[model samples]
Target: MIDGLVGGRLYGEAQIRTGQNGKRFVTCKVRATTNDGDTIFVNVIAFDDEVQTALLALSDADSVALSGALTPKVWTDKNGLIKPAVDMVAHKVLVGYRGES
Candidate 1:
């Protein structure tokens, strides 16, 4: 995994869920713009309570910065087409990055 920062607007409300093993985690989706002017969505997960608290206070309008390790993901579409994507497991997150948005 490579370290990176993903900056973009929060896509929706950050969700807090408990894993089957009883560990709580937070997840947020970010809509990052590509160099080609297109958009790719990334789902960032935070297992740290401090980071989760920070993410909980931010709104979807906020510009966020996620510092973490990049991960690759693959899924099969409804049409049975294989698609690839990138996700980040954020160790640190800077929420409400923009003063106001």
Candidate 2:
């Protein structure tokens, strides 16, 4: 688990959904632009209500700073194609703030 501040822009509407066990959480994608001009989408999740509340305040135009666990994920896409992706479970999320570091 890596802990660092990664800055990115919200790519879509973050949705709050309930898990099988009835726990609520939020999920969305943050698009980070690399120095090479390529974009990387990081799937960000917040499993707690307070964090969820914070994440849901912003929209696609806002930038965010994410802090938590970063990991890789693999799943089948709409075309049934196997894809590999990166994800982060955010314990904290800050919006409308420039990455001042």
The model with the greatest lDDT is 1
Looking at model 1, how many pairs of residues clash? 0
Structural similarity to truth (TM-score) of each candidate: 0.81, 0.78
Top model number, TM-score:
1
- Residue-level lDDT of model 2, residues 17-56, one tens digit each, is 8889988889988888878876677898899677798788
The lDDT for every candidate, in the order shown, is: 0.85, 0.82
lDDT by residue (1-101, candidate 1, tens digit) is 98998888888989999999999999988888888876678888999998898888888857888899998787777999786667999998876544566
TM-score of candidate 2 to 2 decimals: 0.78
TM-score of candidate 1 to 2 decimals: 0.81
Off by over 4 Å in 1: 74-84, 97-101
